[model samples]
Target: MTPTDTRALVAIDLGAESCRVSLLRWLPTGPQCTLVHRFLNNAVETENGLRWKIDAIEAGLMEGLHRCAAIATEGVRSIAVDGWAVDYARLDDDGKAMEDPYCYRDVRNITSEESVHAIIPAAQMRVLTAIGIMRINTLYQLYADKLAGRPQAPWLNLPEYILERLGGRRVSEYTNATHTQLIDMHTGTWATGIFERLELDPEMAAPLVLPGSIVGKVTGELATLPAFADTQLVAPCCHDTASAIAGIPDAADDWAYISSGTWSLVGTLLQEAINTQPAREENLTNFGGAGGRILFHKNVNGMWLLRGCLDVWRAAGKDWSFDELLPLAEAQHTPHHLLDVDDPDLLLPGDMPNRINRQLLERGFGEISTKPEDAPAMTALILHSLAARYAQVLGAIADITGKKLKKLYIVGGGSRNALLNRLTAQATGLEVVVGASESSTLGNFAVQMAAVESSADAETIAEWAGVLRTAF
Candidate 1:
């Protein structure tokens, strides 16, 4: 078999709503990306709690890899995986997952979060980890496992677990690890003090590695195939949000980004960590970014609000598509009462329309009708509320970081919402630049290309990102 037959790269993006597999091949003219496969993904309520269908996820990804081998006749060069952060799989002694990973949205976190704070105050956790204090963070999730008397074993975040399953080493990528709220922001390692205080085992955590580090090559049955024999597994910014941000080719230093999807992360990149009292009080996070930069952002509720409402409408036989709803929403007048987009009640799944109305009634505002015909009005209210929240978060980021933000680049599936973009631009008074919806896939491939060709340093990744942007 010829080793240099092809320079094709594969990128697997695991998302809350859907999982996608994409391929990037170097052509005579430039790089080209193809969507090999995509499938729906959602958490399910199990006897234990809300859990991911990881076995099904693994099977679907394997199918996509086989398809890639068939089409990229020249042979596959490398592979990478990026996805949503905060969820992880605990492994047994035999190096197999004990069970499907828990979904971060489970209600069990509420008690676990309180228990953790009682041991180590929320203020102290922010000071140590520099991450936003959220009940959904992995720190609380792990403690929840302990509180339930689960057996102790090593755990890997979802993305890293996939890489390990593909013959890579067990290690947590920095970008994703920061989301766990267990890393010391100043030292860039696990906060042993917090673990000791909470009595959680520090040894159970995987060693951390930075993005662009290659864990291993393809092994096992697939390695016998010509296309997979020499494939290297690279851990790109394992957090989908970080990869999406890296995919942006913008050169301006004065601009900020919104990785808008299930969650809208609103913030700018910073050279250093900001763990000041005011910054912590604002509930801003300092997630690790590509090239050792800090993704100083706040998590604002995004399309999840609209998605939840859609679920209720679909169950009632409304089944309205975004294509049909966006125009209708755009035509409607501005909503008189905007939602508190970050309301905790709106974060859970099911009956979103009712939950939204309940908040409105309690706040002395008229509720949006949940009738099928009035769906457009609900859409408008959700969009307007999201835009207003984005503006508020961006303003806080600017004040904390002291950066004059000129452009607001919106990436991910949410970028396709023209009405929301227009509202965001109007509310924030910034030049709204719409970025690629598949930014995570693009960023995944860009980092792989940079790592294989030269170095996956900040400069190299940025250059590759610019080159790939032209393909779209």
Candidate 2:
């Protein structure tokens, strides 16, 4: 692809199982981003909690930046990092990371959510902040830490912390801030009221900045590097879901989006946050989106169930690639059993096979397959269950928001699942559009381009994104 006319900007998207770093070369006609590097990301079960291998991710990020520095024709202009939310890195008095951030699936929230909900009823909590109730949310994680007798560390959320570590200022992007449940959706500030009820200090939460704001520039040891001199840091809907939504090329308001990935986030963008009781009852979250929009969606257990089940089978010596199993699983005619994928029991850790089997039995789906060959059917059943659940969430979103959904754009790693995508289309009965495998990074670049452009608007960003897509 011919490179674009404008200067290059890099975006780093940190994910649960992987980290991606890309460079967007903006042209007068449009833009194009080349992924310079990608690396495996893993969370370790630490003595304190389930935490990210933060240093490794940093090393990987730097290596990617170094690659960007190497290939840049004209000097690169800026860099930014965005990742999944709720996980944060504790910092010392001098701002060094005291410890790695905890993974959202760390299972530490065994008892903390109830405690927070006791004082703030689920419905009131929604009215207070317009945050949908969910078990793995940041509020629950924070309460879990306190209940475990751990003191609050002078911590920074991942997005702010990454920029700070790169010698940028400290501030959480508004989109990511909304996930913490510590931010009041109404005031666009930290929810001191919620923190007080939980008896936790609220000052440690990061400040908010709009998407596309220049956070700072690369400094520290890497500052001397050739590529670091002109590198600017920008926050673009740093939350994975928010960035994914921003990357949608279509501008039609009637279209919904399913950020199909480890978590299936299904929703439509709204200018106003829907804090009504029905929205709360449906557990529909209204997170901050790019261009000051709200992402009205629900988090469905996405590819994680499949990934976890495969992990268990792989441990038993049945090496299976997703591609290898897709056809076999797809051929499994009628589902022998289906799961209520949203069941809280499915969210925890254990022998996922046993757990799924137990669930099937509990639901009166009868006995499950015991042989290794039975896995394809079981996996298909899981996917079918997911599609069924997606239908429920899609309808729920429309019902709560009163918005007519024209289409659903699926993005991210799991968006590549053709089998599941087709099923999702059939279930929702809405036109399905498969979008960027690197949507979050694209959104990051789109926001940066918008920030740098003279007249930035959501429509403008989406238009630029359509042009930038030639890189794919």
Candidate 3:
């Protein structure tokens, strides 16, 4: 590839609900972005359990890359990948997949958490990994596998798996690996102690690499594409939320971020890990982030709650679109039932409307209607509940971190919901700054540019990020 400062960069962002491949091309005026391709992503239900359609994802990604190559006549400098964390692909000795990866929502971990807690106890685990205890965490999933007599195979998280498929070395990105609850928060490395306690093979894990590190270059058939020739594969905060946080143009201390998507990760950046008793009790997590910062956040249930109700409606032959629902929701003014969005029951896939009502009744609140005509009320309820949770989490973050959070930045696809944004601002009483809807992709591009133009070191990448603010 030609040595040019202004070549295009491709960002592949994998989400639990959907995935998109974005092309960031430097133009004469500034940087321009094209969402080259996008598609709905879901876990396939099977006789055994829920599994990610990895083959379908691979096909979609190939088509997207072809489209990027067609449009990027000037050639692409490098590519990066980021995605949702925790779930991983198990590979055999020959580096072949054992089966389609299990979805994080699979119920196999329900009984697994108790077993894990028995081994290390929740309090000690939190102090060890500095991760919030959750059934969806990889540690529980792996323990579930062990309980089921599944074969011990090497594993790689989704983004890292994609990198390995792209001729990059097998390695886990720091930001995403923390979500697995397998990394030691203090050493910033794999927690070998946990591995020993659980009787898991430490060799199954790939070595940890920090965000912005160039893992490898485009090789095989992909390298033959004109746009991909000599393209380097950089890991940009491989966790999608981390990438979204990295994309925020401003780096002021007083502003916090909400990486709003299927899940709302609300928190601020920190320089060190917080493993105090209060943080553990509040279920706050401290994960590595871009620029050598720590992401101290809480995972609040987000759009998935509404999407669940939408699924129930569609399955009942009463389909409705967001455009149809949002306006109606905005038109309604009556008080609706509020929910604890993080209720464990709502985390599962099916019968969301019934689940919401069940939760309401259990909490001594009146149930709301889920009929197509009552979509407005149900939508309103979800939004109000989420906004309230955002406010609550923001307050806790301030108390725990002792940071005076003055501004809240809502970045990611959920930022487009004006109704929720208004509620978030009002509820939190903080200056709300709405950022680009494609924050994760933009952050991926920024890191790729830094890796190509200068170095991927945290300090250098952060300096380049400041200079490239106008480009976004």
- Give the top-scoring candidate (TM-score): 1
TM-score of 3: 0.96
Query: What is the total number of backbone clashes in candidate 2?
Result: 3
* lDDT score, candidate 2: 0.81
What would the per-residue lDDT of candidate 1 be over residues 298-415, giving only the tens digit for each residue? 9999999999988888889989988999999999999888999999998888899999999999999987799988999999999999999999988998998899999999999999
Error of 3 at 69 (Å): 1.7
lDDT of 3: 0.87
- Per-model CA lDDT versus the true structure: 0.90, 0.81, 0.87
TM-score, model 1 to reference: 0.98
Per-residue lDDT, model 1, residue 65, is: 91
Q: Give each model's clash number.
A: 0, 3, 0
Tens-place lDDT per residue, model 3, 132-172, is 89889999999999999997789999999998888789999
The segments of candidate 2 whose C-alpha lies over 4 angstroms from its true place after superposition are 1-5, 26-30
Candidate 2 lDDT over 15-56, as tens digits, reads 888899898765555565788899999788778777888889
Give the clashing residue pairs of candidate 1, or none.
none
| Ranking 1 against 3 by lDDT, winner | 1
- Worst lDDT 10-window in candidate 2: 1-10
lDDT at residue 250 of model 2 (Cα atoms): 79
Each candidate: RMSD: 2.0, 2.2, 2.1
**TM-score of each candidate?**
0.98, 0.95, 0.96
Most accurate candidate by lDDT: 1
